[model samples]
Target: PAASKNTIRVNSPRVRCDSASAEKKKIMCTEAEIEQKRLAALAKRRQREQEQQQQQKKR
Candidate 1:
């Protein structure tokens, strides 16, 4: 599956991880969790860009 540029995949929810950590693993996630992470990342990126623009305006 091809995710968009800003999407993050840390052990895809579709795949199972059966390493020594399987006991500590949860393969499936709620839609809310996925969307929350994506939104947080996007907000962080936007903030960084805004800060960069402000710095450029100062210079």
Candidate 2:
């Protein structure tokens, strides 16, 4: 029975490893979200610049 308890103790680190991987996935998801938002904002700014240039040319 003591050997079984030792085996359980040895397996504890695997649980920690699983949680660490979960944390990494969460961080990667947030980073991807941030990148998507940045790209959208950049596209919006470029569109506005193009509209302004077109208006200036019309005048």
Candidate 3:
């Protein structure tokens, strides 16, 4: 009975470890996507500023 209990305890933690790794992967993917969006926004802002400066020079 004690051996069966020990086996159950080990199995439970292994299952939890698998789930935790999957969750970590999901979090990493989201973080990467957020970083990409932030970079794109910065690039767009820089382009707009450059365009404004060009218009000012033309005027």
Query: Quick one: best lDDT, which candidate?
Result: 3
TM-score for predicted model 1 compared with the true structure = 0.50
Clashes of each: 0, 0, 0
Q: Write candidate 3's Cα lDDT for 8-44 as tens digits.
A: 9999999999999999999999999999999999999
Candidate 1 C-alpha error for residue 21, in Å: 27
Poorest 10 consecutive residues of model 2 by lDDT?
9-18
Q: Which stretches in model 3 have alpha-carbon errors above 4 Å?
A: 1-11
Whichever of 1 and 3 has more TM-score, that candidate is 3
Candidate 1 lDDT tens digits, 1-59: 46653244645542445453454543334556888899999999999999999999999
What is the alpha-carbon lDDT of model 2 when measured against the actual structure?
0.98
Weakest ten-residue segment in model 1 by summed lDDT: 5-14
Order the candidate numbers by TM-score, best to worst.
2, 3, 1
lDDT of 3: 0.99
lDDT leaderboard ranking = 3, 2, 1
lDDT against the true structure, each candidate = 0.70, 0.98, 0.99
The alpha-carbon deviation from the true structure for residue 26 of candidate 2, after best TM-score superposition, in angstroms, is 0.8
lDDT of each residue in 1-59, candidate 2, tens digit only: 99999999889988999999999999999999999999999999999999999999999
Cα RMSD to the true fold for all candidates: 18.0, 1.9, 2.2
